[model samples]
Target: MAPPVLVLCRLAPDTLAEFADRFRLLDFYASALPIHAFLAAVAADGDPPRVVLVFGGAPIRVGAELLDAVPSLRCIITISAGLNHIDLTECARRGVQVANAGGIYSADVADYAVGLLFDVLRHVSAGNRYVRRGLWTERGDFVPLGSRIGGKRVGIIGLGNIGSAVARRLEAFGCVVSYHSRRRKEDVPYAYFPSARELAASSDVLVVACALTAETRHIVDRGVLDALGERGVVVNVARGANVDEAELVRALADGRVAGAGLEVFENEPNMPPELMAMDNVVLTPHQAVFTPESMADMRRVVVANLEAFFAGEPLLTLVE
Candidate 1:
């Protein structure tokens, strides 16, 4: 009999059907019951799932409560590069293997990060809004002039795959790129600052591309924004909580920080009302990694990880 694999998020019908052919797929997204009760019922069944497939965007977290309910679970496969939603410590404690979508979306996310930065610095989105509102004829070229992208000092928050890719793209545009990470990367030629504050202090623009963790949460706060100063801009392609949203609002409102381009927010699908009125801010739904090409790559990586786990081979993208 095929091993049961519990699925926790919405997936395309074709993707689900592909998995269903090789394994018994337990559809958690379709379940009407609460997660705990749903898991309870699944556990009560004779054949419990030994694997759980999850993705980002869903509120479901794979932690102790969910882990405890599925005693048979030995593996977790997530179709996301960021593992913030998964409890790595708990998975380690239970001897459960966790595999993530490593480097699959790096190029796409980096491309989007650069796009966001350009939108902020060049007022691309704001100019579009101005034209769309028919203000150009009424105002007669009163739209604010945009800053040049070349020769700007850009500081990146993380130097991982995504961050590194951002740095490379920015470098090609004649932007001087520096970075702040947990540790200085020996392989990269970019200058490294030991702290975010110092990085912000020196940068013309700050691009946040770090992961979300206890330490990284609110890493960019009022102090960092103040350091970036009134002429500096911010572009966040990382998690929303990485920058203190309230502080950012205050900064933008008071003109302490110049502008922003944001993809994610502290509370997703709902953002602060103040941002809607700001012409300098460009907001996109969490779609930095949703290109069709990247989605196909993600599916391949996910399937490979699951195949490796079930076949008793080393995972292609183990968290550790």
Candidate 2:
């Protein structure tokens, strides 16, 4: 008999078919009953699932309470790279091994971050609007000048897999890169700043690529934005909570900061209406890691982790 596994979020049909082949999947998402009632019924069954599969999204939050409902759960496999949605501490306390998508999406996400930065610096999106609206034909060929990307000082937060990839790409474009991480890395050639403010003060553009944790929540606050100055740009590929949304809006509105490129926001699927009207801001719908190639890689990583867990082998991407 196949081992029992609980699925909490909606997955692609192909991915679901693959899981069904290897495990006995108890899908909470497909149940007609409310999730709480379904969980209660499962708990009463007393043969709790040994593993749970989840995705990184707002709807499914795995905390102590959820963990308590599945006392037999020994492993959690998430298809997303960010672990902000999972309660790592509680999982640790309960000896639940956690696995993530690892660096499979690093290259794709890094490429998107650089793309956003270029769009902001060169007014690519705004230029598209100008051309489409016939502003160029109506008002002659004059358009607002954009800053050059070459020789710009770039400061990156987190310096992890994605951040390091971003640095390498920027370097190829003749951009100087520095970074701020929890601690200084001994292997990297780039300069390391002790704090985000110091890094922002010296950088022409600030790129946020850190993970979201209690220590990192709102890490890029008003002070950091101010340090970037009136002529500086901010690009965030990390979690939206990493920057204070209200402070960022105020900074852009008052012209305290030059511009922004955002792929994430404090609220998913919703953003401040003021940003919609700004030509200097470039926004994407959290698609930094949505490439088809990356999606395939993610599926492989997730399956690998689950296979490893069931085989009693070391997980491919264990969160430690």
Candidate 3:
């Protein structure tokens, strides 16, 4: 019998096909039963799955409750760069190995971040709406001028793979880049601020590209937004919780911050209704890494990590 693997989230058909017959996949994601009940049923079957496959975007959490329900689980493979949904602490306590997509989606996410910034700075989406509504023809030269991307001081939060990529892309556009991370990177050429507020104070554009954790939750609060001033733009491609959505909404409303480009929200699929009415704000569903190339690359990385785990080799993207 092939090794049994528990699948906890929906996967793309191409990704599922990659598994083929190598493992007997227990389709927990397709089941209607609640997660706990599903795990109980799997446990009662006397063939507890040793490996669990998960996706990062889903709200499903692999924490103590889930871990306790499946004692036989030895490994978890997530097809996303962000591991905020998974409980690394509990997984470590149980000695369960966890692997993620690593930097596979970094370039794609960076591109999306820059695109969002450009849209906000240049009022691209708002202008498109104006043209489509025939307002431009009705009222000639009435549209407000937009800020230029060139020569903007762009400050990036968490200068990791995605942030670094954003910096590089923005540099090509003649934007000056600086950063604020947990620590200043010795190898990086950009100036580093010790805190987000300081970075915002010095920046014309602030980009949030950090992971979501207790320390980072609402990291971009009112102080940071106020420091960015009325002419500054904020772009967040990271987890929604990384920024205080309420504070952001208020900032935009009061003109404390000029505008924002958000791809994620504090609540999934639901955002503050006020943001929808703002012409200066640009919003998108969390799809920074949804490109065809990134999807294929994600599938490859996930399969390679699973293969390595089953082969008793070191995981290709171990989360440690």
Candidate 4:
């Protein structure tokens, strides 16, 4: 008989050993079949593994049939904090357990978010782009003007793990920090706003780090953008869904906001044409969690989820 199978859609090559060692110890998990092929394998095999350990870039339809086809699949674990890709409702209906890696690694992301803020505020990319294009000498002084980081009001959305981390970094620069979330956490020292609109209206810089949820999709619409005013800038390190893409393009194109820093887009891998044409925008390839340390830590959480499930123990980070 084949060893019991455990489905992991995709994992970094370096992360395989940790998972392999944990699974190798369990008789059923040791033989736990590995299926990296994705939905095709899920569809082809009628009987499913006892659990599915999802990672970055993992794609499963998670429709009614996804749970129906794998009756044996008792748990679904996603290694990332973002919930945009997973289907929570369907999983709940099927009584399948769910878990997500949350707060495992947020410091690096906070650093990157602040780096992008300073990168845009200081015109670091604009300066670099000019230098590389042979226009640095002519435009260096006036093209990308410098601004004082101190005494500026910084507004943050969704002050969770990553957001709190960002708040600390920004406060170190002597900026007055305010934020908006579903509710306030008594532990955080930052000022809290009742709504995002209020935060935007008063801020010099708006950093969006909210989760991608039904209520938060496109929370930063024209109203919020306009609230930030022409001198303000926006930085988004959260899901692309939180900001209105069309409105953002118009704002950047018309100089509504001073500038924008985008690390994630509404559509992954396909950035809008309007964004590419603008010079006031600094873009990143969804690499906020690309640091070697963050990746390893995230991988550990993923493997732990898998190992715990196979051992018939409690999951490390169950989302539902």
| lDDT per model vs. reference | 0.91, 0.90, 0.90, 0.78
Candidate 1 lands at a TM-score of 0.97
Better lDDT candidate (3, 4): 3
How does model 2 score by TM-score? 0.96
Clashing residue pair totals per candidate (backbone < 3 A): 0, 0, 0, 4
For candidate 3, write residues 186-224 as lDDT tens digits: 998999999999999999999999988898999999999
RMSD of each: 1.2, 1.5, 1.3, 4.0
Comparing 1 and 4 by TM-score, which wins? 1
- By lDDT, the best candidate is 1
In terms of lDDT, model 2 sits at 0.90
The sequence of per-residue lDDT tens digits that candidate 2 reaches over residues 292-318 is: 798788778877888899899999999
By lDDT, the candidates rank as 1, 2, 3, 4
Q: State in Å the error of residue 190, model 1.
A: 0.8
lDDT of 3: 0.90
The TM-scores, one per candidate, come to: 0.97, 0.96, 0.97, 0.88
